[model samples]
Target: MKNTIVVAGATGNLGHSICTELIKAGTHVKAIVRDSSDPLKVDALKKIGVEIIEVTQFKEKELTPICQGASCVVSAVTGLHDVIVNAQLELLHAAIAAGVPRFIPSDFSSEFTNIPEGENRNFDLRKEFGQHLEKSSIKATTIFNGCFADILRYNTPLFNVKGQTVAYYDDKAYWKIDFTTMDDTAAFTAKAALDATTPRYLRIASFRVSPNDLVALSEQYKDKRFKLVDMGSMEGFSAYNKIQRAQDSAGEDELYPKWQQAQYLYSMFLVHHEALDNDRYLDLMWSKVEDNI
Candidate 1:
C-alpha cells in the first residue's frame, strides 16, 4: 500500500481544502471524521476517492492502528478551548503511537506565542497546546498564516466589506496585518506535510494589509469610498483587558467578554507586526488581495 496521509477534522473548511490539495498532488489521503459529520461532506469526500474513517474520540489505542501505514497526520480542528487542548492532544499521542513521522497541529492564525496571555482565549489555547507538543516526543510543525483572508471578505462583524466600513480600536491606519486565504494556507500545509525536511515552524502571509490598504482596495474594487471608525485609543484596549480578566475570574459565559478580548487582539496586530515567510516557499503560488477583493 502507498504511504497515506491522515487528516483529522477533514470535514472542516481548512481540512477539506488541505485534503483537496493533497489529492490534486496525487497523494493518498485518509480523512478522519466523526459519525456526526454532515452526510453531504462525507459523500463528497468519498466521491473524490478519499478514504473516510469515523472515530468517536481521539484515543491513542483506537487511533494507532487506524493511523497505521500513514506517514503524516494533519489536524485542522478549530474552536476556542476543548477542541484545541483535549482533542488535539489525544491526536498527537495517537500519532506518536502509530510512529507517524510528521504531525501538523491546527494553528492557522496569528503567531499566538507573540501575544500575551489573558488577552485572547483562542490564541492562549493554541499557545498552551504548542507547549504541550514541545514536551512530547511527536515531531510537529506549526503553521502561523495570520488572519484568514476569507474572514476579511465575508465575516461582516470582523471586516464588514458590504457596509464599506471598518471599526478599529487604534487611531492610526498604518498597522500591517497578515491575511492568508484558506486555500493558500491549506496548499502550503499539504506541501509542508509531504516534505520531510520542512522546518518545525512556518510563518506564511498571502498578503499584508492595513486599514489604509483595505480602504484603498475597497475604493479600487467597488469604486466607492470607505468609512473608517476608530473605536478608541489603547486605553480602551486596556479597559477591555481588565474586563476580560474579570470575566475569566468570574467564569461567566457572556459574549461581550469575547468581544472585549478581540479588541485586545486587534491591538496586538498593530503593535507586533512580524515579517512574512512567503518567499521561503518559492514554488508555491500565493493569491493576491486584489483577486480576493
Candidate 2:
C-alpha cells in the first residue's frame, strides 16, 4: 500500500521538499498549511497536485481532522520553544487519536541530548517533548541536521562568509561544525518516513567543514582574497547561559521570550565536539543526492 503522509507547515522550504520527494517516490501527500486563503502558497502547492487543508490554529482537537487518514506526520513549524512544544504535543495527541503510526518532529537542529535539560531552556522543552513521545504509542524520530549550509548564502553573522567578518567562534581558524543542505535533510526525512523501522534521533549532515575551509572555498570560487575575522564567541555556551539566567530573572513574558533558548540550541555543535552519522540506513537514502554536487 502506498503511504499517505500529511505534512504540517507544508508551505515551508523543508516541508515542501519533503512533500515533493515523497510524491516523486509514489507516496500520497496531503499538505497542511495555516491559511488556504493565501493564494500564492496554496496555489503553488495545488499546482503540484498536493491536497491542501487550511488550519487556523494547531490545537490537538482542531488538527485531529487534518491528519485523519494519514499514515505519518511531519512538522516543519518554527517559532518559540513553548509554542513548538505545545503544537507538537497537540500533534502527538492528534496523531495518536487519528491512528497515525509515525511522527517526525520539527527538530532539525543540534544534538539535544548533549546539552543538559536545565542548562539550555529551549532544549529542556525539547527533552520534555521527547519524553512525551516516548510515553506515547506512536513512533517518533527527531532529526538533527546541524546547521543549514545554504543559510550561508544569506550572509548572516551566524554562518558568516560575507566580507571580512566571521562571527561567534573563539578561533575562526580552528572552528569546525557539521552542516547539511535543506535538500539533503528533506530527502533523508522522506526516506525515513517511508521505512517501517525508524530510530528515535537521526543526525543528518553532508560534511563537517571549518569556517576557514569555507572562506578558502569562497576565495577559490569567487577568485578574491577574503580575510577571516573571529567574532570572539559572543554566541557560545557561556553567553547562552547568561541570557537564560537573565530571562529567568526577568520572567517568561519578556519581549524576547526564547531567543537565548534558541541560541543554546544552535550552540551545541560548538561546545560539544560530537558529530554523529548513522550509515546503517541513511547511506541508502543519501545515494540519491550523492552525485548532485
Candidate 3:
C-alpha cells in the first residue's frame, strides 16, 4: 500500500486507537514515535503490522522521508503550544514535503472553531495552528469529535458517579452535548484518512447526550435514581471559571490546570458538533450513552 497513512504520536491513547483501526482496516500505517518511546509500546505497534520510526527531532527534513509515499498524515499528538503548534507544524511541513496529499491535525475536541478564540487554552493552541494550516499546500481535515465519551464514567460535575447526579447549568438541560468514544473517533478518522473526498472539517459524536437523558440512562443502568444537579446559569459558570483562572495563575506552566478543566466544561455547554459526518462511514458502530454508563 506504500504507506497509505503516516501517523505521528502513535503511542498515545487516541493515537494508538487510530493506528489500530487503520491496521484493522488493512491500511499501511507508518507510526512516528520518539527515540525515548517505551519499548513495550513500540513492540505492540510492530506486532500489529505498523512500521514504527523513532526520531530524535521533529524537523521537516528528517520527517519528510518517513512520510514519503504516504497518502495522508494524521497527528494524534496532544499538548500545549510546544507540542500542539510546534510538533504538528513540523508534521504538516513533512507531509507537504513528502508530497502527501492529505493531513489531519490533532484537533479531536469540541467544536472549537465555532467557539470564539481564547476561550479555551488548548483550543487556542489549535486555533494558532489553524493559521499555518490555512496557508499550507496539502489538503487538511480537522475532526471535531466533541468530548470523549470516556469522561461520562469519570463522574465529572456533568455525570458524577459518586454523587449519582447529572449536572447542568442554565437552560442546558435539554441541550445535546456531544460525546464520541476514542475508538469511534479512531474508526472514523481511519476511514477518513483513506477517503480522498473528505472535506476540511468533520464533526462527529457517538452520542449527543442530554443531561436529562444522561440521568435517566444512569438510573436505568445503575439501578439507582440519579439526581439532576442544577449548577446555576452558564454565565455564572463562566464567571467562576474566570475567577478560577485568576486564582490559578500558578497553573500557567501546567498542561491542564484546574482553570483549564473549567474552561473545557464551559466549552462543552457553549457549542455543539453540528452537521455531523458520522453517517459518512456506515460500517462503524458508535458507542452509546448507556454503554458508557
RMSD of each candidate relative to the true structure: 2.8, 4.3, 1.2
Residue-by-residue lDDT tens digits, candidate 3, 152-251: 8777888888988888889889989999999899989999998999999999999898889887887789898789988998888888877887888788
Global lDDT of each candidate = 0.78, 0.70, 0.89
- How many angstroms is residue 153 displaced in model 2 relative to the true structure, after the best TM-score fit? 2.1
Off by over 4 Å in 3: 1-3
User: Could you give the candidate ranking by lDDT, starting with the highest?
Assistant: 3, 1, 2
Per-candidate clashes come to: 0, 0, 0
> Judged by lDDT relative to the true structure, which candidate is superior, 1 or 3?
3
Per-model TM against the reference:
0.89, 0.80, 0.97
Tens-place lDDT digits, model 2, residues 16-100: 8888888888898888777644678778777787888888877888888878778789987665555567888888899999989
Better of 1 and 2 by lDDT: 1
Better of 2 and 3 by lDDT: 3
Query: Which digits, one per residue and each the tens of the lDDT, describe model 1 over residues 1-293?
Result: 55589999898878988999889888899998888999999888888888999988767776788777788999998765677888888888888888898899998777777666756666777888998899988778888888777767663533567787866666557777787899999999988888787677888888887777777777888788678767677667666666766757543343235554465356445454366667766888999988876
